[model samples]
Target: MALLERITGPRDLRDLTNDQLVTLAQEIRASLIANVSRTGGHLGPNLGAVELTIALHRVFDSPRDPLIFDTGHQSYVHKMLTGRQHRFDTLRKPGGLSGYPSRAESEHDWVESSHASSALSWAEGMAKGFALKGEPRTVVAIVGDGSLTGGMTWEALNNIAVEPDLRLVIVVNDNGRSYNPTIGGLATRLHGLGQQLSAIRTDRRYERALARIKRWVNRTPVVGEPAYDLMHGFKAGVKDVLAPQGMYSDLGIKYLGPIDGHDLKSLELAFEQAKQFDGGPVIVHAITQKGRGFAAAEQHEEDRFHAVGPIDQVTGEPLTTSSARTWTQAFGDELARIGATDDRVVAITAAMLHPTGLTRFAKHFPERTFDVGIAEQHAVASAAGLARAGLHPVVAIYATFLNRAFDQLLMDVALHGEGVTFVLDRAGITGPDGASHHGMWDLALLGLVPGLRLAVPRDEQRLQEALQACVRIDDGPSAIRFSKDPLPAALRPVRHEDGLDVLVEHGDPRVLVVGWGQFATMAVEVGNRLAQQGIGVRVVDPVWALPTPKALIAQAGAHDLVLTIEDGGLAGGLGSRLAQECRLAGVRADVREFGIPQRFIDHGTRAGILDDLCLTAQQLARLATETVLAGDPEPAPDQADQRG
Candidate 1:
């Protein structure tokens, strides 16, 4: 039987010989390439994690042991071994498997740790629970060194340092990259340690002996305290001659590697030593290549094929290509142009230079750009300082990542009133990456923050214009959000209104249809179709969906029935704000809303998600027609005076 086909669980891996395990690693890599080629995923991460995951499964029992993975992008190999191999074809499909680790997926998958640096804290809590239950179960945390850059990792490390009884085992996957070649001191430290490991040969026996010797020397004699201290000093002196242990040991955690991550046997032995030691938390730092096996992924410079779209498996070329730009590309190109004229225009990102559309800007103004590793809070707070220094800083990031820096935006940026522009890519319904990846909360959350100017641009022209406009504002913090989908060129707007752009219109427009951002195109199409059905509709861009759209309220008062369409969360979103404005404007018309509900949406195609949310033009038209027919709105006294 084939190695992969025979293994259904971790227990099955325990009996495999070293040669057989190595073969299984190859099979896993082949499978990863084959599957990820069809449905794009974290190719480089999964490839790098093959042996580490195999070693982890062979060493510890999951679910019982509670294996937690930080930044679940590297969990594909874990999923394959835990009995989901047959469903590889349905990788990121709607009803099939999720891209990230899901609690509902399997018993082996415990925590839904999609965010970075979260596994350490989660493992801490799980260890406490196990101790309380009087259960002797192990807790393992496999965190990337990139995640160590985040403040939460340090917070968890501080707590884990004092609580010796937590009995947590930590595996620091020192891949030296997270989305991009990692930045800041943590990356430099990890990279330096990785080089030191390379200088020494990959040897488990020698490393194990050193660990045993260190533990023995650190052990107290119970009665002879003076003797033990003297012996410890002598051993420390000997180790100073022999050496390895930097920033990690200084923080009170036992430092183990600079081990070769690809060496399955070596990694297994290291993990075994860690499991046996109950002294305190141990960090098994295994140096790994991000895109280990795949040639195309390994050769790439930027992120080493960190994430990709469906591509040709052999050539590593994208299957589909567009002539126009993605929202990311558009933003990056425009920002580069902005940086040309303004010396103060600077760019910042949280180790996501390429993904956040800052790559071009960084190239154009290398000195003006800053990549702050995987720390979002630092990214925002630092931008506030940059803003105060008489510079226009544009902090570009994914909208969901913005959640991590919300407190900073409120306190540091907004409270102090800094003129920082936040460029949010993937603002709504970012499909395939699942719940945590979708940036559905930005539009609503930005509403609650005080003294923030926000803009949602529908097309490339407006997106560029909006970015420049936000940068020009010196009042406080500002943001401009755009979709990942390519903006349609065919559906250009007819004209512009007061803070609104009329995309399309027909007849008297009894039912005024307002759309925010990219949804304005759909709203125009809805209006065109509704015109065929003898119902008039007018489409407008509510340009920025913040500070209450007064223009929409004014326009709503004149129409018999008003409808609003948005691509974000329903609660406190554009639609809800429009309703509030209409009521306050004394417009007695029935204002219908269309948007995603205030719940975590699942992975699917963009069209599938929109259709489900009733955000599609056809669905929007149907829903609007039904509501208009059900309670044909009656114009109130204020509507009569407003129209006149």
Candidate 2:
């Protein structure tokens, strides 16, 4: 039998021989490649975390002693060891195991982590709870080097410094890259070698004394200058003897090492020592490669197979390529074109330059692009600063991530009326990633922001037009939202009535259908079916989803039956807002709405979820037809060859 099958839980790892453990590690790696090849996931992060996870399980008993992951992408190995091997093949599939740590999955899993850089704060709270309850247990927080760039990590550390006697272990997996090799000062400090490396926590008086001694020694002779230079240059070894502590030590947290994370024995020993630490919260600094096992991931350093679609297990080649251009590709190509002409245009992303379609923009203007780590709040606030300085900063980020900077958007950008354009990709139900990942809340939340004009483009051309229009805005903030779905053919407006594009017009229409953003195409199918049923209908795709257009309100008032559809939250969404606005305007229309319900939608395929939610074209068309039939129908006036 395979060694991994025998070991189902953390206790089973205790009896295994060192040789057997090594064999198990190999099996686990093979299993990872096998399972992830068919169902794509966070392969690189999980591969890098094998030894460290095994060591963690060996040292600390979970369920009793909670181990929390910052960005839980690296918890795949943890899942394997904790009796989840049977369900291993179902990873990321609907009704199967989730990609991140799920509380519903097992008792070993504590936090359902997806967003970055929040483990330390969670650990601190858990630590405090253990202390209050008189429970003698260690709280371990595993954070990545990339996550350290977030302000929350430092915020937790500062607070943890106050209670230095707490039993807390923060394991910083210093693998160097976030999605694409990390940037900023923290990454440099983590990789710095020699004596200056320990200077992160060096005392001021000691530095002065060392400087004085160096000057005096150098003044003596040629030997002294050479000796000083040699000692400073050999910082890797000599500095450890002189300056042993680092940034964590200065913050009152005990420091561990620049230990090799892949070395199972070394990691086990380091974690064991951290377990016995009584001084304060300690940080175990383990250096590791992002993609330790797979050759393809190791060779491709950036992201290192960070996320993938279905691919060959051995060769690591993708199985297929999408033929249709997505909204992201359209945005990236257009943004690059915009950057070529406008020198004031700068790009900012919160550790998502590539995913948010800023890669082309960065390639075109490297100096103008700034990746401010995984700090979303900082990205918005910094954009406000750039705008105040008379420069246009285009902040491209996921719609889900924008939730992190709502306060900043309202206070810093909107209050001051900064001319910042936010380009939100994945602006609707991002399937397979689960509830927290879906960008379903942006439309609802952005409605609360005064002077904020949000444009939900219907197709590729509209996305380009919306982005250009947002750039032209001189006051407040303007944002354009687009989904990760494939870009359909450009829908040409048959006619425009007060900026509302008439996509499909029927002769003397009584029922009017308003489609918002990507839902515009779906509404066309509904209109086509309605025309066949001998129901005269007019379908219009609104350019600006928010701040209801005057013509839209007037059209709704004229029609007895009006239906609005949006690929967003039902509450305060385009449909809900439009219905509310029309009602207040004294429109005698029976307004019907279709959208995502006000609940945490679970993980599933986008098509499956839409079908289940009754958002599909066939289901919506039938519902709209029935609703229109219930209302009083308008007389067929001048049917201009309605039947093609």
Q: Which number leads on TM-score?
A: 1
* lDDT (tens digit, per residue) of candidate 2 on 110-185: 9988888899899999999999899999999999847888988889999998987689998878776742343222
The all-Cα superposition gives candidate 1 an RMSD in Å to the true structure of 5.7
After superposition, the stretches of candidate 2 with alpha carbons farther than 4 Å from their true spots are: 178-245, 630-644
TM-score of 2: 0.89
Q: lDDT values of the candidates?
A: 0.80, 0.82
Per-candidate TM-scores read 0.89, 0.89
lDDT of 1: 0.80
Best candidate, lDDT: 2
